[model samples]
Target chain A: MNEATIQVQKLTKRFGDFTAVNNISFEVSTGEVFGFLGANGAGKTTAIRMLCGLSKPTSGWGRVAGFDITREPEMIKKNIGYMSQKFSLYDDLKVWENIRLFAGIYGVPHHTIATKTDEMLQRLGFASEKNSLVKSLPMGWKQKLAFSVAIFHKPKIVFLDEPTGGVDPLTRRQFWELIYEAATQGITVFVTTHYMDEAEYCNRVSIMVDGRIDAIGTPKQLKQQFESESIDEVFRKLARRATRKEV
Target chain B: MLVFLIEKEFKQIIRHSFIPKLLIVFPVMVMLVFPWAATMEIKNISINITDLDHSTLSKKLVQKISASNYFRLTGLSSSHADAIEEIEFGNADILLEIKSGFEKQLIREGATNVSISSNAVNGAKGGLGAAYLSGILQEYTMEQLAILGIKPVPVIKTTESYLFNPMLNYKIFIIPAIITMLLTMLCGFLPALNIVGEKEAGTMEQINVTPVPKFSFILAKLIPYWIIGVIALSLCFALANLFYGLTPSGSISTIYIFAAIFLLVVSGLGLIISNYSSTLQQAMFVMFFFMMIMILISGLFTPVSSMPKWAQLITMINPLKYFIQVMRAVYLKGSGMGELTVQMVALIFFAVGANIWAVISYRKTTH
Candidate 1:
């Protein structure tokens, strides 16, 4: 039962005269941690947005979480959660309040919300600060809490857009641990990040450059194939090759 | 979906420090400014008393004109020369003068002429003041005729009455309009800014990527504001009732129903503004532009009929104009729902149409 949870076939997005996502295709399997690596404006966020049903592709098609992205956006929305790199929590609200709001928006049952909130707070070691305002929390705690809240609805697929952008390396490590935990619990993690070390933790990774995925493979295979010591070096070599081809 | 959005919205607004300012300051400003701005009672008018006859009759006429609430007597000149001076100086709006032998001629021949000159500035106020001055003169002339043996003159006397506001307190006429303005301004400005503020803070991108429906997101944005608007309207109503004795004379339930419709329409306008603007500054400018146009053309301070045809047509499209007219008509005239049907229809049209447009225009992708 290793069927693809997400399937993209010739997906392309255009804005006016400019193309944001060129003819690109990829598939993510169930319970797999798929890392999307790209620099800024690399179409990684655009591709992820298309998969999350937040954006419509100009041509081609895709299915996300067993639903057509184009035809059944609402159905797909119901089955996936999204955590943006911008950290979307309302800072004025208390930590628990933000969680409750997300839970309610996802239509979680009241009893389920209570238990899930309790479990989440306990897991984050934020039990004592549950009632404290979210703005008062440290950046790392907010990031971790944001991730937990995104997956709180038990969505089958979670799209994370650079979820660890500015966090310290230690916090980044903790974030990967949480991602691994979610994956072990059978949640598919679709993450986009600039951090190459984080790419090593994913089951598979796709590196995008200039609106197209330039490389896709396991981290070890990619490094070995590029004759590189790290994922960063492999990405640099691939990106250079892709740019050289453009010239 | 609406419930979910509204719950989060309430939480967000509750934690906002300036919410109390929004609820209290805005309505109070409206209540205070409405009475000052919206009035037909002529003030600072220049009167030129042309005393061609300088007799007690003409002097008494001048005194009577000066004593009335409407006229602001600029100068009391003895000669037509000085009266003309006051009028030409633009210092006086209405000019009154008694022709020479005015009292003796009226007593002896039972007919005397009094000359009146008006500046005609702010033509409406000038014309109204001129008519009122004629009425006052007619009363004085009648009194003089009674003193003499002017028999069987068949005097047609007029007993003056103010239609709705008998006391002629400007505040009474204005509070309802002010209430409508406060709701519209707050609903239109606050929610428009809130959404853009989220975008500015980079939080909207996060919220946008979520599975939360746009309808729910918009509803959540408006719920707290709608509640705040209700509170503000209530407080303004209470203050008006307590301090100004401004009470809704129509069916209170009907007024409230109309008010609720008006609130929804204005809130819909806010959502539309928010959707069009990508930044808080753009939203504010758009809202301010509409608010100014709405206030100017709303018949709040200016008569809709008095405007040019194109302006009148524009005013008809403005939701605030209809709501203000509805509010004033209901509160002062005790007008029935039947009388307010057109206004109610306009409000409903704006509310439904604007909200639908707002919802439809809100794209999941950034432009």
Candidate 2:
């Protein structure tokens, strides 16, 4: 297998008396599309937050992009990009301006920023709307733009938390095309989602139930192991036993 | 990276529909209107008089009170009961009663008493009105004694001269303080809202995930507001000079130096509030609560010397109090750094303390 981009062991996060992410473990290879699926309160976000260096785990440890999650969070941050569940772009900023801002923040070379921003805008077919405010764009376009900006720094791994949320199927399909393009360029994609069909697109999928990984395998392997015709049924069978209600 | 962050902040502020206009209009409106509305100098007290003795002395006293600009003779009743009724109905703030034997008693005994009653609900106005009436009566008695060809006992005379503000113009006293208040509100509230607004919009979460250091992020957030604050202070100074012909008596750079430190204290406080609050509403309420207490207790509208000892002690910790004192001293008294070292040191302490607290509280990662 290709070198592991993410390696975890017994990663756990607790909030007071409640454990948000239980002692779960997993790994993802370089350039693989890993789908992290869970119910509403199934601790997917909690685990993702730990991996993205946004929060510390209560116990145990993991590494992302070869940096210790706890001791080297800043190092991890420098090597990975993140797109949150909510729209996170500055709505008041112009399209090219937003691109230049993230590029500048990611330490893209100063002299090349203007040219790179123009090229990226043209590639996204957003060159015509370069001066328009981000808020003026439609939701699908905004999501696409946010995703593009997330990977603009060419990080080794990009963690996306529900990047296709609230979009129509056509937009989701287009967004997946961008993800596949990034993967082909050798960027690891760690995504969390509610859409089951989108889960079928992942090279490896993990279905989490009550903060525990109930199933983790290739789509066909999970379906075959669960004696089901599709990954959706496999997910339902594993998720039905969860005692934690959706929050 | 820090440059980019500050650029983004400036872009957001300029693109905001209301904030840019507010930056210009708010200070202009405050400078134009507040100096007139917020003056502490009391004028036009309505007085009621009951002159039972229609003698020359009583008549002259009545004329003297009426002629003074401070008092308007709103009522002239024959009885004290009627005069007191005007005060009860709120038409008058003070009442003076002259007995029927007033002039005769003064002539025979060389002394007489007149009763004075004032509605002290608005204590400053009422007290000052009664005091002016007493001065007028004493002058009338002295003139009467001279006309009677009676030699009076010698008394020591006191010459009063108001320092700093010879004319005692309340506008000149209040304008600098108002400017201090404007800086407090503008520099204080904007940064608090700026950070919390980013949180509410979820942009802060995105920024947190990046490799940007916390210090650079916070500095980026504070620097733009600091620039805006200095510009707002300049705008206030320009407007005050244009409309009221008021200029700081001291070096303008001295005011700027103190204003720069004061902005750090206020903006640091704002950052601390934003670091704790997650929503704009929560941040605004917390900021408003602190601002109300600070502005009121900072001696902006009232004298800190007049407050209770405990309240004065509280003002000792209020950064606004030190800044307002510095502003007033420099603008009105031509006080230089040598004369204002204590206030300067207090503000410096607050600036350092608040900024350190802000930087310490702002965490890049949540526990």
Candidate 3:
């Protein structure tokens, strides 16, 4: 019912003879936490790369943040924030410096950078560690800081590619709390992840198998449609039909 | 935004435990040690003399050769065979044999042949040693004729004077080239490693996702190294002054102008290497491969004129060769922009060509 922040129609990407992402279509309204679920090589990353304007699609069309993916990649870049699976923060840089660097890159107003950095550090209870090098922080704190820095410029949409990967469950829950906070502030969250439980936290989830979206619905609806007791069962049932193994 | 990128680069460079120290120590060690070690000037050639004549003139020749700095008279033998044996044992580099009746023949016939043989295994040392001995012999003959009052036909005399480096100090020639080497390594390898380091760390992926312009990103990567290169050059000049009492003969500004263009060329080359390589190891090997070829063929240690025609042609494209010429000319010959226009144009061409290639090859998005 709400306005779609992302729109796709028959978006596909092919490499040589193999089609990486095949005719996948999806839409997510503003402020919704959309979970993109798939196996390792089911083309989730390839599709996300195309949507994020990082890779050109071989065919079809997609739009993000009111810009065509093919023609307006730079505009899409300006309106989006991305946190990759790998730790993105400069380890040698101080926490505040990392925040400032990203803020400056994202074209956050220069004057507000200091105030915003201080506010974010205080909110994360990282005020005392503001001057500490990012490498000195624990892994969980680094992930949280990376996520916060990703959205520091306050882009309309933030794409998290396995943002909570390799972290403990409790830290992951806290990370999600931050995601929820961003969503409440009207930022669309497009996230891909491996954990089934994490998928349940999404407002709606898409299950991709063999480069195609096999199912898409709310968690409860997917569970009922698959005749399963949990979203995990719904995922396993859809994932079983995958012809391509994890790469 | 560019400021932020450059600031991040400087912070990383300064924070690295080894890089900052290496920046200072590397130049100092290279300037302090390499000049003395890299000298091509031949000295202290060992000579065994066989005085078969045993005449005063023959004995005087042996003393003259020994007293001269170039040759050390290792021993005097009764026979030429003994002296040749010394050369075979490698104890002596050359053997001078004054034949029988050296002074009698010179006075009676006004001419006599003296034999000189040298082990030419080390061609430069051997050849130079023999030439120096002959010069001493000619001086002795001219003096003998003057003393004996035996007037011969008019003799053509030639007086040689060395320009630029009158004393022919090897350091004056090499120190400038060393400075060029320092800039090449500092500006060349660091930037080559920088972007690939980010790729290895996965930060490049994060930077790519931002709205940062590609040119801004590349400029940010290069500007810090350019500044570092200038600083390293200053340090080299300072050390050369302190240790070797050497200063550039020409205007310092001319050197800086060429150095500025040369830095862009090398850093651009580095960026091009970085753009193509996906891993740090890949980048380092590729850089090392290029650096070895460039530094060697650039005429850093040897003269480019001496190389084979094909190898000499390769130096035409070598940016280091042009910069080395500029440095040597400005530092030793007091040459200015007027004298170095060809090299200046070559450097500018490389600077533009390399940097444009670097920027074009750098892809912000994956294909």
Docking class of 2: high
Which scores better on lDDT, 1 or 3? 3
Summarize candidate 1's per-residue lDDT along B259-330 as a digit string, tens digits: 777777778788888878888889999999988988888987767899999999998799888888878888
Sequence-dependent TM-score of model 3: 0.94
* CA lDDT, candidate 2, residue A240: 87
Where's the lowest-lDDT run of ten residues in candidate 3 chain B? Answer: B146-155
* Best candidate, TM-score: 2
- Per-residue CA lDDT of model 3 for B1-367, tens digit only, reads 9999999999999999888998999999999999999989888999999889988887887888889988887888889889889999988999988999998999997777899999999999989988988888888888888888887547798988999999989999899989999899989999999999898898888888898998899999999889989999999999999999999999999999999999999999999999999998999999999999999999988999999999999999999999999899999889999999999899999999998889888887777
Q: Using DockQ as the measure, what is the rank order of every candidate, best first? A: 2, 3, 1
TM, every model: 0.88, 0.97, 0.94
Report how far residue B167 has shifted in candidate 2, in Å: 1.6
lDDT of 2 at B98: 95
Error of 3 at B151 (Å): 4.5
lDDT digits (tens) for residues A31-73 of candidate 3? 8999999888999889988888889999999999999998888
- Model 2 Cα shift for residue B148 (angstroms): 4.0
